[model samples]
Every structure is written in C-alpha cells, then in structure tokens.
Target: MAALACSPADLLPLLGGNATSAAAEYICGRFDAVSSKFVDTGYAVDNTYLLFSTYLVFSMQIGFAMLCAGSVRAKNTMNIMLTNVLDAATGSFFYYLFGFALAFGTPSNGFIGQHFFGLSKFPSQSFDYGFFLFQWAFAIAAAGITSGSIAERTQFGAYLIYSSFLTGLVYPIASHWFWSADGWASPARADNLLFGSGVIDFAGSGVVHMVGGIAGLWGALIEGPRIGRFDHSGKPVTLRGHSATLVVLGTFLLWFGWYGFNPGSFLNILKAYGVSGSYYGQWSAIGRTAVTTTLAGSTAALTTLFGKRVLVGHWNVTDVCNGLLGGFAAITAGCAVVDPWAAILCGFVAAWVLIGFNKLAEKLKYDDPLEAAQLHGGCGAWGLLFTGLFAKQAYVNEVYPGVENRPYGLFMGGGGGLLAAQVVQILVVAAWTSVTMGTLFFILHKMKLLRISHEEEVAGMDLTSHGGLAYEFEAEEKKEISF
Candidate 1:
C-alpha cells in the first residue's frame, strides 16, 4: 500500500519546510482548491439544468394557446391565440420589472421581497439569472392558465391588464409566502413546528395553478358566460368547439409539457448541501418525481375514460382531456414526496374531483370552457391534501434535509397534524386567490372593460377583434366552389 500510494506532498519540502510540515500545508492547499472547484462546478451544472428546464416550461405557453384555441369557437380561435401570445409577453415584462424581486428578494418581515428589481440584485457571478428565468416561466404560466376559462368574450385590453397584475402582484405575493425562505408558510420558516414543514407543496399546485383557476372563476362570473351559453330558461347549451382533433392534439402537448412542469419543480438536486459526493449528478429526486407525474396523469386519463362512460352513458373526449390535466394538477404538490402507488391513487381520485367540480361549476351557472375551475382549482386543493395523506417520510427527508422535525403522511403513522396543516394551506391559498383575482375582475367589470359588446361577441372575435379568421382555407375553398 505504501508503494502504491507515494507521498506527492513530500516534494513540497524542497520549497522550504520539513517533509511533515510541507506535506500538511500542501494537502490543505489542495483541499481548499478542490472544494472551491466543487462549488463552482456544482453551480454551473445546476444553473444549466435550471436554464434548460425553464425553456421546457416556456414551451407550455404554446400548449396553452393550442388548448384554448381548440376549445373555443372557430371564430374566436385567432383571438385566443393572440391573447395567449400577449399573455406571455405582457406577463414577462411585469415580472421582470418587479415580480421576481417581490417574490425572492430580501425578506421584508416575511411578507414581501424588497430587492432584485430591475435585476440589480442579481450578482454578476451567481446562479440567480437561471432562477429568475425559471420563475418567470412559472409566473407567465399562471397568468396564461386563466385565459382558457374566460375565453370567447373577454376583451383583449382587459386580458392584458389581468396578465400584468396576476404575474406582477398577486401571484408573486403568494409565491413569497410559500416559496421564500423567511416566509410564514414555509415549513422551514414556520414559527410553529406542529404544522408539518409549513405546507409541503413540492411544486406550485396552490401557488401557480390554484391562482389561475380562481382567477378564471372570477372572470367567468364577471363576464357572465358566453352569449347563448345559457338559454332564457337558464338551461345550459353545449356549444361544442370547432375541432375535436385539435383538442386531442392540444391535450397531448400539455401532457408533454407537464413533464417539465412537475419534474422541473425540483429545480436541481445538485443544490448546496445535497447528497455528499453526488458530483456526477446521478442522485436526485427528479427521476422519481417524473415517474409520479407520469403515473398520475396516465392513471387519471384511464380512470376518467371509463368513469365518464358509466356516468354519462357515453365517452366524452373533452372530459377525458380534463381528467388528464386534473391528474397532473393533483400530483404536482406531492409528486416529489409521495410513493408511486400513492400517486396513482391521487390521479384516480383527481379524475372524480374534476368531474365533481365541473358539475358544481355548471350548477352554479359558471361556464368554464376548459374546465379550469375543476381541473386546476379543485385538483390543486386535492393535490395538497393528498400530499398530506400519502407523502412518505423518507422522500420528504430526501427533499428537505437537516430537519429532524420534517413532515410525514398521516398513513405513515405521523398523526393528523400534517393533514391538518395541509387543510389550512388549501384554505389559505383559496382565500388569497379569491380575494385578489376577484377584486381585479370586479374592478375591471365596473369599468366596463372586461367583456365585448353583444354584437361583437356574436360577430366572432377573430373578425371583430383581430380583423381576420384563423383558417383562411375555408374561405378559399368556398371561393373556388363558387367560381
């Protein structure tokens, strides 16, 4: 062994000191150099992951646009597409101006962030740029989700305003409370340890999807459903969209996008204080979370397909897509913490949640075009609660280390405390979204800027709002026939 491991440190004695002293100094210097290299390399590797993941998340905007455009009337397709594009653009501007700072800047009594405005707080040599970019993707996603529920009749100018506040103020404040280190809702920052790690939302079921879902409900109410959505007798009319083919295509795109949404939520497992010697980047919860996300969506899709057939005497394509999305929303909060089997359960049950809430929304005379109220709002709540019930203690430990008092599932013998905290989390998130988005829509409604005129609504937004239809092929075909 001695022959095999020659003491390279012994050569340091030629510089000045005795072999023992020089060896010790040389080893210490090398240790420092290696450690510095480790930190720098880790940062680069992790930041690259964040940047790529954020790009994937940004692609979901295209998914949202396609989904909403297919779900609306053909005449309004261009309007939906245009609004979706502008949603990202407008939300990005506002988020860059102040949203990132408000969510992640220096803590201000755990209420709001107070730095990073104009990117000033982003260090020249820090990983913060990737973090901000990833977070901006999330901010825009939340705003874009709201567009689907209130489609067909919403005024373009009003939607832009909605995007600005949702990305800049409302969503950021909620993000601060749940995601920031010093926020009151953080399990890590909670003053009371009894609350089970401060409401463990691995992703942003409550922070992102829930906010958008609630905003959608408010917009539906303030805009008072599309024209002829309900008859004189207040009976609902099923106004089918122009393209089931497009709807199916859009659902698949969203499913692909959610791989980025759920797994990417981990940001990076190479984060500081991660698994020891995990420099090769093999060890991470990302794989498991990705599996859970896939299982949840797949399970919910199959479950809804059969369940809807039994309940309605036939299969509905739209409900199938809603179930798929509901499953994704449900698993999001607990994907990193729950077992694969538990994720299956979450998805299966989330399908029913979507159905129930869709029925509830219809009963209340609220028309949600893409079932946003059910798929996101209802399943977002269920996802949070399901995490409390099914989260594994070991998985929680892996995600959040160094905490002896972390959370575990109720079924795992951790008592009802974690479940209780999850309930409070759901309620608080719902209330916050309701208050903020409701107020925004209400003020917009009072100003008469929220909806288009009745004539404009019937005339079709593509022609009335955008001065053209999305598919000119139909007109061209007709022209050829007439000739």
Candidate 2:
C-alpha cells in the first residue's frame, strides 16, 4: 500500500503552522506544491540523474577497454576486449534478473530483503525506475573491476558464468546488507558486534569494488599468474599498459562518474528535511556532499603525484589515476557527514595508503594485474574506516538525528566505540565476501572452467573467443617516434 501524503508544500496548511511550511520549502528544494502532489515527477528527475550517472559510469567501460587492451601483451588484446564486453552484457542481464531484487527488495526485519528471483513484483508496481538505473551502473562497474584482474588467461565461458553469479548473487547480496533500507550494513541501524554499525560503505567500499577485486584475487590465485607474469623463481617481471594515455583517460572518467555515484546516494534528494526552520536540512547536506567529494578527489590526485616521486623516483600516471580513485573511495563514507577539511585528510591519507598497499600487494604476490586489489579492496576498507574517524557531530545530528545517530568517532570525542564498530564491519564484510568468492572460484577451478588454454591466451581472445581481432597491422608501421 502507498503512503498517502499532503503536498509537501501543503504540509504547513495541513498542520496549520508557518514554521513547518517554511521548513518544508527548504527541505523540498526545487520541488513545489504541485510537485509534491506528483511523487513520480521527483522520481522522474532522479531517474534522469540515474540515467546520466549510468552513462558516466558506463563510459569507464571504454576507458577500461582501452586501458586493459593497451596494458596486456598484443597477443591477448582481443581476449581483454572480449572479457570487458561480455562482462557488461552478461552482468547487466543477471543484475536485472535477480540482482536488483536481492539487493534492493523491500526490507524485511531490517536485515535481508525477501524478494525472489528478478524484479517479479516490484517493476510492475510504482517503483523507482531512476534508482534502478543508477544501481545498474554499479553492477557494471563491479563486473569491470575484475576484467583487468583476470584478463590474460580467463576462459570466456568461465567469465560468463562468473559475471552472472557476481552481478546477480554475489555483489547484489553484499550491497543489500550495506546500502539497502533493511540491509545489515544500513547506516540507520544501531551497532551490533556481529555486523558492526551496519556497514557504512556510502559508495561501495565492500559493495562494488572489493567484492569484484576480491573475486578477481581468488580467480587469479586459482588460475595462477598469467603464464609469464611471474618468472620460474617467483619474481615478478614488469608489464606495461599498451597506452599510457588510455590509463589516464580511464582514471578521469572514473573520477567524473564518482560525483554522480556519491552525491546521488540520497536518492530522493529533493524530499529530505530536518526539524522545523532548520537550515542544516536535506538539500543543504546534499550540496555539501558534492563539495566534499570533489575536494577529496583533487587532494588525492595531488598527493599521489607527490608520493610517486618519493617512492618510485618518478611520477607515474597509473599511480595518480589509482590514487584519485582510492581517495574517492576513501572519502565515500564520510562525504555526506565529514567537513571539507576532513575530506582533504581523507584524500591525502588515502593516496599514501594506496601507494603503500600497491607495494604490499606486489610483494605479497597477489598478481592483481590492475592492482584492483589495492585500489578497491585495500583502499575501500580504508574509506570505511575513514568515515568512522572523521564523521562529525553537526552533520551526524542533522542527517541521522536522535535515535538514528550512532557514537561519534574518536576525533570527534565520541571515544573508541565508533572505531571498534568500523573494525567489526571490515572483518565481517571481508570474511563473507572472501569466503563466498573463494568457494565459487574453487568450484569453477575444479570443473576446469576457469582458464583458457595456453594457445588461446597467446593468440589473443578477440580471435579465440569472439572470432576477430581488435586491431590488424597488415599495413606498414608509421614510425614517428616522439621524444
């Protein structure tokens, strides 16, 4: 049954209060009296934003396609392209079929959603179509994160199954716990030792990136490194992305898309409100969120540039790109609650942590081709923790108020409770995702559906899997070397 409401503008009239009407206007932003009567109009705008965000997020596919194709050996060029393409197609279908239902189904007991396979009942009803599209963008991004990880040797058929399971079951289920209304990870809940302060992954530290990256890690381990990525002595050899330009472009696209990803979290941005006559209400908060997100991204980019010189003796594009992503991911949790300066700290530390984790992942032999493990998994975890540390009292009070507000971070003088809550969240999400993804990999490995034959890998997936090459060098090379 739908919840009937007087026009948001008419709220004051119904309640017979001037303060309430003034508060309603402030909270409603661009929506007016007539606008309040038509809930679907607001939904329409969100849907449009959702579509625009999807377009932005999906653009990363081109960035990844270019970046991944250019990164691996030419022999595997087509293979990379095929993997990127299929993952998007198959992942979208699977997400639509059951993923949305699992992740965003109507709440049940404030834990897991109870809808069955696909969007059986909801799509036909008065559903938020815009929100659905925005979520679809996330599903695609999650699938793409693993493309770089399993690029060279993963079998096309195996990847198809992997994409389906990940988008439909794995990623969706995790996202449900963190972002959905009744999810275990919902920020609205009180802290529980078993689940932590519901999981504060504002933009999917564990939901999208880590889930995909860890799955990639498991796939990498089960399949072993690309035949030549590591030598017989177990030392890694250097491999270059075919085009540095593609990598930079991909990074920029991701950064741009993140604006939509984070600020759009308040799906019904135009409808949120605070106490009567309060200025620090819904619309005000969302505007602040946008500003903090941008600050974090820019600061992270600068810090990564500086860190590269200190650590690697040169400024590397890949480091800067991933640094920005790490910063964005790290700030995601606090974007809505932390002040602008906190975002800078979040960005700076996030870059430093990303550089450190990159080295650690390399030393540990994770064989994360895209370093997705560090960019998303390591940094994603950092983002969640950063939120616990930086979340503020004013913002927290305004957003959550009263009962919904949890303990403040240590920096905010709330004590160690918030930090401990974060730690619990990290452990549980990590364990659940890792165990589930690892088991799936093991099963696929045992069935011999994990990797391609050495010959196919060497020849390139374009020809082997998709029956064509992405590029043909039949003509003479135009050698105009740039200095």
Candidate 3:
C-alpha cells in the first residue's frame, strides 16, 4: 500500500520573507478552514499506544514463570516454566477464538456477550484490533496465575483442560461483568447500577486478579497438598523456594510490567477524559496513575520487610516478593481513581492483607504453592474497596463524563455507596469463579486426571512428566557399575 501524499500547494510555506503577505494569509485561511472539518482523528497514535502497552503486559508471563519456577523445588523448574510458556501459546488462540467475543460482544445481554465469532460483526479498525490484542494479553495473564498456584503437583494434561476453560469461558464472563460497555456493572448504564452508578474496577483488580485467586483457591483444595507439605499431625511444613534471586528478579519484572497494566487500562490517552485530543487531561491521568502505582508497591515492600521481621525475626525475601505483588494487585483497581496518599494507604494495608491471608491459608491447610489466593485474590479485593474508600468525586467526574450519578469514595464525602458495590463485586466474582473452576477441576479429578501418581510426585514431576531434568548439571555423577 502506498502512503497518502499532500499536494505541493499544501506544502507551500506560509511564513517566509520571500512570501507575499497575501499568500501567507491564504495558506493560514486554508488550514483553519480544513482543520476543524478533519479532526486529528488520533487513531494511529492511540492504537499504537495500545499495542505498545499490550506488548509490555505480555512480558508478565516471564515474570510469572520465573516467580513460580524459583518458588518451587528445583525439580519442578522445567515443568513450571513450560506451563507458563504454554499459557501464552495456548491462551492466545483460546481467547482469540472465543474469549474476546464472550467478553466484549456487541448487542450484549448484560450477562454474556451474545455476538462474535467471525470478523463479520467486529469492526476491522485499528482501535478494535488493538483493543483485542491488548485484552488478549491481560486474559492470558489472568490464566497464568492459576498455573503458578497449581505448580509441581498437577498433571500437565489436566492443566491444559483447566486453562482452556478459564481463558475461553471463565475469565471472559468475569471481565464482561465489569469491563464491557453494556455490562450491568458498567457505570454508563443507569438503571442497573450496583450502588451510585455501577461497580468500579478501573484496571481489573477484581476482574483479572481475583478471578485467578478464586480459581487458585479451588485448585489448591481439589489438588490437595504436595508430598511433605503436611506432617502426620497435619502441621504445615515449610517448603521454601529454590531461588530467592529469581523470585526477586521476577518481582522486578512484574513491577515494570504494571506501568502498562495500570495506566494502559485507560485505553486511549488522547480521549480518556472526554473531548477527543485533550492531551493534558490524558497526560495528567497517566502521570497520576504512575505515581500511585509506584507508591503502592514501594510502600508495601517496605511494610512487608518490617512486618515479616516482627513475625519471624527475619525478613523473608519470598514474602517481600509476595508483598510487591500484593501491592501491585491492590493498587490496580484504583490507580487511576485515587490520590497518591490513598495508594500508599492501600499498599500499606495490602502488605498485611497478604501476610494475614498467607498465614490463614496455611492454617486452613490450603496447599497453594505460590500463595496466589492471598496475594492476587485478597489484595485484589482490597484494591476495589480502597478505591471506594478514597477515590475523589472530582477525579471520578473527570474520568467518567456525565458522572453525576456515578459512585465515589467514602472519605471524599461520597458516602458508603461505592464501597458497598465493591464488596458485592468481589463477592459475586469470587463465587462465580469458585463454582466454575471447582466444577472444572472436579470433573478432571473424577476422570482420574488431575494430578500425577504418588510415585511420580515423589520422584519429581520433571522426571516423570517431561522425561527429563530441569537441573541435569546438578545431578550426582553416576558410579561405575559392579560386574
């Protein structure tokens, strides 16, 4: 395809000593006449931004892979890494084939999307395509969380079945409830508003993170504990990760990726605050979101350090990594809605949320290898309620045009309406996720395909499942055979 070209006359300079004053006036007059008629249209810039952010978010799979790999015994490293890799490989196709349609299909029924399969219904514009690709990345990330929690024990084949169900069916419906334009939870709709206008989950703390968390919860329960995870008395045994360095490194990658996950949720910076091409408004929101995201993570990491020290007399690096993730998950729902101080407060509480939930899950005998339920689920729910408690009305109005009826925070004098909606939002999503994932895992369990044999688990999944070792170099040298 050839690029569009302007006429030589259009290129004629209007400001020069050599040019006549009349010519300059004519050029100026022509530009003014056409400028308003053909508005900037900003499609290329906006779509490109979406593509870039989506690409960045896609990198989070690496973060998840490394974090899970390092958190597990060295024997499961290859298995864990392969699962993360397969998430993107398989999840992309699954979401592309059916998930996108189920999530954002037009003529929505306010429950599930009723349309979408072929391109016959979807627009072929840059924005449409960009939105699909961007959300595809997010959908995969949400599914990836489950892989980590179920690592080391579950059969590789069973993981695939659950993955397909989640990315194709479970995740999309959960996302549609809060993100799709026609969803009952959508603020744009008036009559179905959960509280003031609707439920508010700006960047999917409840949608993405909590969905994963709930699935992780059911997965842990159904799969049961790994070998040696509990004693004869049912006391929990500490099975530490193999590499703190990799865990910390993975944490850094996730933190970096969140710059996209949070700010990029706005979709279009040129038009987010209303009146297309309001650059200042978009830029302001982006900057504020970044500051809040950073503060939340930083404050939570610091808080976790101190809290862990007090709890165990030693600062646990894995806890620190979880703290970082919990903070990121906690602030995601409100990054664009709340002030920096609120983000700090949200993160400060998020660290303890992770700590508290981690202990509680252990106490309750939930064998979550990666603590996904506590970090993603608990902190994600916290993110939504934090927004309802701290988001300002003025910012809400700016973000949502004609937001007179929309909800805002409690401390900002907006009452407890939004907070109530947030509580319901998390509960409803949590229930939905539990039922669906529980059924999926239960079916797999009944079929005798959920986990590997006890012998295989004792021998390590890497050897039995993949037919190889993740740490071949670490193997002891073979002794000479006797005659």
**Number of the top-ranking candidate, with TM-score as the measure:** 1
In terms of lDDT, model 3 sits at: 0.84
Relative to the true structure, candidate 3 reaches a TM of 0.90
Residues 251-303 of candidate 1 have per-residue lDDT tens digits of 88878877777787777756433455654332357878888999998899999
Candidate 3: tens digits of C-alpha lDDT, residues 72-93: 9988888999999888888888
Query: Residue 201: error of model 1 in Å?
Result: 0.8
Clashing pairs in 1: 187-197, 187-198
Q: Sorted on TM-score, highest at the top, how do the candidates line up?
A: 1, 3, 2
Regions of model 2 farther than 4 Å from truth: 1-47, 109-111, 123-126, 189-197, 272-281, 401-405, 474-483
Model 2 gets an lDDT of: 0.73
Clashing pairs in 3: none
- Candidate lDDT values, in order: 0.83, 0.73, 0.84
